[model samples]
Target chain A: MELSLFDVVGPVMIGPSSSHTAGAARLARVARQIAGDFVRVSFGLHGSFAKTGWGHGTDRALVAGALGLTERDERLRDSFEMAKAAGLEYDFYTADLDVPHENAVKMTFFSADGGRLDVVGASLGGGRIVITRIGEYPAEVTADAPTLVIVQKDRKGMVSQVSQILAAHDINIGVMRLSRTARGEVACCVIETDGELPDGVLGEVRSVPGVLSARSVSV
Target chain B: MYSCFADVERLCAERGIEPVQLFVENEMRLTGRTEREVYDRMDARLTIMEDAANRALSGPLGSVGGLIDGLAQAQWRYAQGARTLCGAFLNRVMARALSCSEVNASMGRICAAPTAGSCGILPAVLLTMQEQYALPRRSVLDALLTASGFGAVVMKNATVAGAEGGCQAECGVAGAMAAAAAVQLRGGSLAQMLSAFSLVLVNCMGLVCDPVAGLVQVPCAQRNASQAVGALLAADMALSGQLFPIPADQVVEAMARVGRQLPIELKETAQGGIAATRRGREIAREILHRERA
Candidate 1:
């Protein structure tokens, strides 16, 4: 991604370190969006996030994010207290992800409606983050982009059909990745676009012949 | 992204405006926001910087690990004494910087002017100037934009990551940004601002990123605070007609090269420098044991 002036001068956030704190918050925020109405979140912090995260407020930063707070929210200092008031149940565990990236976290979100999602993300320095995994699927998507995330039955023409819809809408695809747990069983497709998805694009994707679910997260 | 500083300088010259307009335009293109949106957003960040620094100066807080705290108060005491080495203005710069750094160490909210570890430099310098000289808030924001312009240039040309380049990339670049902004805020021309920016980078080049115990406290906070003084001195020298000789772009490249020459142990690994010392290791272990509980 081209570096912006704000990327250099801003990302105004609560911080002792941008990666450990701000990016961690961002990871949790995305996880929050993925797992709607989550009641319980088990955070498996890895490497540097597990070792020194306590001192850097990574723990609280994650809690604030799950509560739908931005990094700049001044009430971030009261996240722990506010979380309790909001009736959110969460836990933290030290994780070993077999990865070298120092700032990593695995979040398991349990929604009140009996949905469970597991996400692994890394804070790639400077408050930028990548959602590296979703459930049993290996995926790569950045929060900096307007993205379409789809989980579907793995079969022929799934990639082509999805691109056709996006191309039809004049939405330029910046990046697209198709990763399946195994061939012809289940797959995840993450599309990052140059323009915002036109309204109702998610419904069109969901109505596709073989898609299990579709969601678009706007930047 | 811009490849070098000369490109930025040339763009600014052709536009017949300060480097700040370059930053504003670039921000608009990159973020797709209007000029009002960009400046207003920056104004909000500027407000946060001042608020965090002021909170720190109003009272000191113990760092989370308790390594450095109350030093701002001690500095204030020394500044109150007769025949101090630096005057009250410089003392306030240090105090403001220390306050923000110390606040950051305590996990208080602060702007990551470039990064959190070096957040204090620009704020300390600008907020101090805002109070001492009564510069308009808009002008302060413009200085911040001037700082941001060079900041983007350096981040693009080289590396700003301590793990990639060392303290020279983090605090070093921050000092340069602060110096350039200070020059702009004080009515210096673009040439003087660039010279000051180069001078600060030239001075801070090759500084290691060996924070004790992999924490952003200790040397990090102190560096953030002291570099404000370094920035002011650079700005003063540039304003007094001193030249930095090397162009800003080459200086950034030199800093990047020097960073690669630094050993990994010194690049935020906590395995060398003060972090390898007995006290440093002890502190790390103690903090780890406590956190586990």
Candidate 2:
């Protein structure tokens, strides 16, 4: 590797833990976009993050962020109180997992209109976050644009059918991951196709009898 | 914004931007404080750390903790000694009063790339390098600019949440950012800077976000201490003419991948690692129960 002075010291930021607090705020904000308003949030902490969520203020930061707060927002402490003040409810819990990450959080957010989303996200060091799960499905998709998360039945040709529609529009799938429930009765296909999913594509896919629900994420 | 270390150097050559000028502007943007304020904060924080180390050293403690205390004292003294060469390194102590004390008191501040509890690592390293290298403050400023850009990329690319990616994203990234700056300070080329970053990322990858008792006071401080050493070592590797096999992009991507594989408990939930303990959890419950009562 070629050496440069910039590589040694790059940026300045807040501290204690960047990935846990900053990334959690961003994750909660993203979750808010999908979860919508008038919802409840329940956060489950794993490993070290779980043990010190309150002390590290990870839980408060997440809740504040879910309510639309940024890392620099002075109201974050109040943001937690504001949730209840705004009639928003939330809870916190802890779970154990045999994993390498010492910092992990599983957040379940509920929307008022019967929309429920569960996001399992991890804060890698350096204030970075990855959303690994949405609900029971493997929604570990990238935040890149033109992505579609389709909750559909576990049936043959379903993926190809969706691909065909996307292909017809000249849309390319950058990354795709599919997972099914343990019972195998339901499955989800999350396609991070490039350049928008096309307006009618989502409606048409939803129209499919086997398709349960579909959502789009813009990077 | 800084795709490669070359970009930073190129900008310097093309725009005649000195490192100190760039450093000042970038410092203001990143910390919401002026260059003078940052200088003051740096001095104050280093002083505080030194005092803490001296106090800890005066007493008989475990070898590891004692060694850290002594090292910390030395780092502060080093910064203090270089104050003349790095005149900007000294400042009023009050400038660094914790901005998010509530978060730290009740929960804890997320010091983007620093230990939320310590919240002074990046600045500490930056100021120290400026003083130690006796480089033009302008050059240091430019390095700071490049570093902020790198930080933004990390914030966009991976994550900064310990709960999500663990302390790796926090202090790990901070160290990497600092390593990049250090390489630049040593007048290493772009390739060297990126190599330094690769070394920093690979070494600190997947560091968990377990804060004992949820307080940023304990392991958080220790983590910052280690992070400083890591940053220096990574920079030294690149400055010493050693090369990293992996590219910066690949290293960052691998970090993201590793973060994904880590269980939620380890990320920052305080559930799995240091957070989950017969004593730690009991303390948490007791605190919460006390709050309720």
Candidate 3:
């Protein structure tokens, strides 16, 4: 996407370092969207995020994001207390992850309803982030636009089916990535759209043949 | 593409339009947003910048690192005192710069003019200009759009990331952006605005981004204050018809070249410059220990 004047001038974020704080918060916020509602989340910091994330308030920012706070929320500073009040369990660990980026984190989230998810993302500075992985699938989700993540059985015409549904709804696809473990096995399709997916699009997608689960995320 | 100041100048000359007009139209074309929408968005950003610039003056803000707290309030008090060196306007400018940076360090909300680390400089100059001159909101917003134009050129030709180009990219470009905006706010000509932009880049070239403890405190906040002052001085020189030997686009390219030559240690790694000092190491260790505890 072309960089706008607004992109140059502002994200209007809670800050100290854009990469460590604002970007970290955004990465976690996107992770939350991908993972859905979670009662507990653990952040595994890597490289610079592990080295100086504490001082830069990456931990607090990450926690705030897990609680669904936007980067501009002033409650970011007191996010730990807010998390406590919200009954959101959180933990931070310095982990050795073989990520290319210095500002990376691996997050695992658990819900009281026995749902679990794993997301790994990196802060690419200036409050930008790329979610590199979701669950066991390698992914590239930037959250720059509204996105749909679909888990499905690797089968013929799955992409065409999803694209047709989106086309039927007048949602234009900007970028799409499809990955799978092996032929006819489980696969993940991540599609970023130019227009918002109207209500019931997810239901329509989930009802597609061989589709396992689907979620829509916007940031 | 608005790739350079020379292009901006040539276009303005060809069309006999102001830089803000060109910028606003370009934004409209690029984003498919109306002029009013663009202006309203910028006004919202201005509101954010204003809030961040003023928040720390009312009370001390504690930083997450425990490295910088109450410094902006202290500067505010000093600015308010009977005896100070920078006079009332510049002192408050410095204080507001510090205030925004302090708010940033404390994880308060702020607009990242280019990057969060240098968020203070532009808002400090623009807000102080508005306050001192009672400038119209339209004028301040125009100045902001003008600044973003210059910043976009820098981003196109070079960068604004400290990790990629050191503090020169973050704070230096921010100072240049602020200087250009200040020149516009003062009704200076396009040449003067470009001159101010070039002067700031020349003055702040090769500045490193070695935040102590790898945190955006200590030197970062002070650098914002000093660069805010530098931006004002650059604008003053430009408005007075002073010119640089090198053109603004070349200056931005030079900054990019110098930034590329900077070692990784000096580029936000916290492994060189002040971050490498013995005391800096001690502070890092202490902060880490405290956090672990």
Best model per TM-score: 3
Q: What is the per-residue lDDT of model 3 for residues A1-219, given as tens digits with 9 covering 90 to 100?
A: 146898899889988878888888888888888887789999999998988788888999999888888888888889999999989999988898877998999999998999889899999888889999888889999999999999999978999999999999999999999988645399999999998889999999999989998989877
Clashing residue pairs in candidate 1 (N, C-alpha, C atoms within 3 angstroms): none
DockQ of each: 0.58, 0.10, 0.70
Better of 1 and 2 by lDDT: 1
- The better candidate by DockQ, 2 or 3, is 3
RMSD of each candidate relative to the true structure = 2.9, 11.1, 1.6
lDDT of 2: 0.61
Question: Estimated TM-score per prediction?
Answer: 0.90, 0.53, 0.97
The complex in candidate 1 yields a DockQ of 0.58
Q: Please state the CAPRI-style docking class of candidate 3.
A: medium
Write out fnat for all predictions, comma-separated.
0.72, 0.19, 0.81
* Candidate 2 regions with alpha-carbon error over 4 angstroms: A1-16, A30-38, A68-75, A96-102, A111-121, A130-133, A142-146, A164-171, A182-185, A194-201, B1-111, B114-119, B124-141, B145-214, B218-293
**Model 2, range B1-293, lDDT digits (tens) per residue?**
24444454566567776434544455566546766775555444433333322332222222211112233333344444545442323221111112222123333232333335434456556655655567675565556555655655565567655656787876687778778877878778767877887788899887887755555544555566566567778888899998898767778878888888889888655677766878767766776665446
| Residue pair clashes in candidate 3 | none
